[model samples]
Target: MDHAPALVVCLTTVSDEKQAEALARTLLQERVAACVQVDAPIRSFYCWDGKDCVDRELRLVIKTTRERATALQQTILRCHPYDQPQVVILDCSGADPGYAHWVGENTTED
Candidate 1:
């Protein structure tokens, strides 16, 4: 099956579940993301400033098309409380045709 050209899955880690849910709702309300799945707490190890740290964070899995990526990211930045939020975009291929079409249809064209 042919997948949507711009289809993508965006990932981000939030400080807590509350923040994750709020971000998800805002993205959906703004029509920037077709769906947002909030995952359980995850242990993350990274360096910040000059120190290494470990944190418990909630993960947000966002589904949208590349056309809406910029807008989606902007929304996240605007709503995110963290100084530097993790926003990773992953290209998607071989997706279920119906689901891919749904994502495209739900998100804004630009």
Candidate 2:
């Protein structure tokens, strides 16, 4: 059995590649995320407010630790362009220890 300590994976989507890049860069620059992978555009179907909507959005896969979760969410909210941006985090305690350790190491301040 392997434990990842406080490792977590966060998911968020943006309207465009530029926004995706901005968000990823900010998180890395602030040391709140070890890595942010920008995925190709995905078609999203959901209800916003009172209307049904469908959109092509770019997803960002953020890797970090629970210790940096708050900062990660705050930074996303501060930088995201959506009226209600998606900031979802999932515990990754079952991940490979070595990979999880790498994420923790890169996200911590020097």
lDDT by candidate, in order shown: 0.89, 0.90
Off by over 4 Å in 1: 1-5
Instruction: Put down candidate 2 lDDT per residue, 4-103, tens digits, no spaces.
Output: 5578899999999899988899999999999999998899999998899999999999999999998999999998899899999998767778888888
lDDT of 1 by residue, 1-110 (tens): 55564688999999887898889999999999999998989999999999999999999999999888888899988999799999898888887888888898899654
The TM-score values for the models, in the order shown, are 0.91, 0.91
User: Lowest lDDT 10-mer window, candidate 1?
Assistant: 1-10
Model 2 lDDT at residue 13 = 98
Q: How accurate is candidate 2 locally (lDDT)?
A: 0.90
